[model samples]
Target: MRCFIFVVFLSSVAAWSEPFRPWLIAAYGDTTNQTDRYQMGNDNTVIDIYTNLMWESGFLNVSTINLANKNCVSLFKNGYSDWRVPTVHEIQSLLDYVNAPGINEDYFTSLPSNESVLVTSSSSLQPTDLVLVVQQQTRSISSQYPPDMNVRCVRGPQRTAPLDRYTKFQYADKNFVKDQATGIGWMTESSAIWFCDQAVDLSQVWTPTIKALFSLFNQSNSPLIDEAVFSLPSMLYLGSSTPVAGENGYLWAIDGSTGLFQTVPLLGPAMAYCATVQLD
Candidate 1:
């Protein structure tokens, strides 16, 4: 019944801004106004106090995306009938990358004690062919032949990230092209590799997160990013926003070829791409 403008402090993510931040800030919580975001609601439901969205704590195991979609909408949970499948980004909001199973167990205490991926509404490169999963790691799965993946529904005002509003505008000679939605300026690089300590030489260093990549870069066609800006290398990119617990200055290596990431020790001179974060 009210609105609040908040800043989402994504630990190591710097590309997200504006429209996406409102919804995303709910995930990471507002550093400016911190509170217990996830709280117990009615039976089998968890309320995100920050997002004003209720999440289905009890998950369903479905083999196909169609089944997952059907189950969420039809079932009536605690008098709420607006439940539906969540996008890959929506699922990523709940991923606690540092922990096993990758979900915060404090409020979401119903995680199945089995290795299973969660289904998302967003489709992959080929529609109906590939369905991406959101877990500790994001991987493509056969939409139809999936092995009983998990599905968690949400009931809230539906609003997607305003990522399609990428407008190329020039400001003097610097930052000639930029994604207007987010105040991030993508720096193009070739086979050059850089370390985290290389930030002193660069404007600002930020490691890409799976959630940020899932929202901004994953294109329908060939090249992962906008080819006009770059023909991105298929090598591991340096730095990650999500660090493994107990490992300081350590992060995941993003496979540029498929956008797949895994937590490993410095993947040897990763091809670097820089983005300067411009705050509003």
Candidate 2:
């Protein structure tokens, strides 16, 4: 079993003031358009060229984590036997931000229905109390295990991009300040508007264009920008100033835990920032 030291309950999404949509922050520059990184594979699987991860749409029909891991170990598929349960982060990468139910349907031949929740190999701070979850567009932390939770397997090394790909920014520790670094508090469009008007160097940090915001997670296969600098438990939802293409009165926010990106009301909460100086 994967033992982790961080545990967050479902209530974490709700806010003391307002629900701040979660998003991961990064320090680096430039983002490559991730349009063509996949190819179809046999045995109802899809291969991510960049991550070199072969995802099997099946090996499905397992309920518990133990059963899922056992199946992966004993089973072989598509001429490969190195399969294992995927981490929540790897599953998060498969989410399709532009599509509903948050997955790329064109590549994978099968997936759990929208109602079905997918479990990962990761453990919560309290392993028995929680586990990492992925379904549709959002990745979440859940205490209750659905009766028929689904499990999928992946094979190959965890691909990691070099640090040079993202824009570099510094942040105060998530301790005294909860604003941008931890994504724990409310920050709305008005705040971004205020920053833009003030002419701050990193003013665009909060309300950056879609490309700049997505660049944070798009640059890495793992959910985090830098594990050395941040802790998984400290991150929360982030709201971006970017507007959804067809949806009026809606802006995009990313769930830092699940890597889900979807629209929320413009006045709703979101926190995101990257800077050189400490956040006061």
Candidate 3:
């Protein structure tokens, strides 16, 4: 009896122990395009690929995949169901300190060859190239642009710094000198002007195209403002001790002053400078 009980306990434990299968089988359906198929390279899978690549490249620990299914809040895979669509903060985390590994362009390029077997109710047709083309287009548009500029035009009235020195304001608990950084209190079409609490130490911020920013903002729900903040085209920030003029390139500040600045690829190298005002 004792051995039998022990065996039963072990069986119960084994039953409970499950590994998380982060990957989910997703079906692509387009009623308008009349395209439906089980595509391997979808948004969720793309995100997974990025996550995996980043993790393998020593960028992250937990490989979390964002599920696109609305019906599934969270799913049990690999013995864990703590998975859900990443919050704005979580998505931001993925973007944090994202340099070297940059975007996994190679992963994107190789997607066509990674197609999985089609699983569909419609036996009349198999997945078509049109489906892949649509997916590729969507991804191309999304990955090509930055997130800041996309929402700028949609943002309400341009709150230009009427005065040189503006007061400081707080957004999401982050205090910022007003008007100094185009980043401060600027409105977007969706909401009022808000400052980013988590300002990067970098001197400039890059404004991506309005479309890019909108998609990223909507998808990630990041607290970082889409309008006004000076984001570096790439992720290069200068310290206060660094010389401002001619050291790197000239950056036009919010106060209409052009100073020496460094350029990074993250911010378009050609259009690098952004307006940053001095609060003090």
Instruction: Provide backbone clash counts, one per model.
Output: 0, 17, 39
> For residues 132-234, could you state the per-residue lDDT of candidate 1 as single tens digits?
5443332222122235566677665444335454454443232323455344555554434444226555445444443444444453345655667665666
Candidate 2, residues 1-280: lDDT per residue as tens digits?
3212111111111112222222232211112124676677877777775445678864366656667767666657787766766654455456544455445566653343444445543321111223644444332323334556556677655333333323333432222123332232222222332253244454433345332344344212454344433333333656555555457777666666655565667665555533222211
Best candidate per TM-score, number?
Answer: 1
Estimated TM-score for each candidate: 0.66, 0.54, 0.22
TM-score of 1: 0.66
CA lDDT, every prediction? 0.48, 0.45, 0.20
| Candidate 2 Cα errors over 4 Å, as ranges | 1-35, 110-114, 122-130, 137-144, 159-237, 240-264, 274-280
User: What lDDT score is found at residue 208 in candidate 3?
Assistant: 25
Query: lDDT score, residue 224, model 3?
Result: 22
lDDT of 3 at 238: 20
Instruction: Indicate whether candidate 1 or candidate 3 has the larger TM-score.
Output: 1
Which candidate number would show the highest lDDT if scored against the true structure? 1
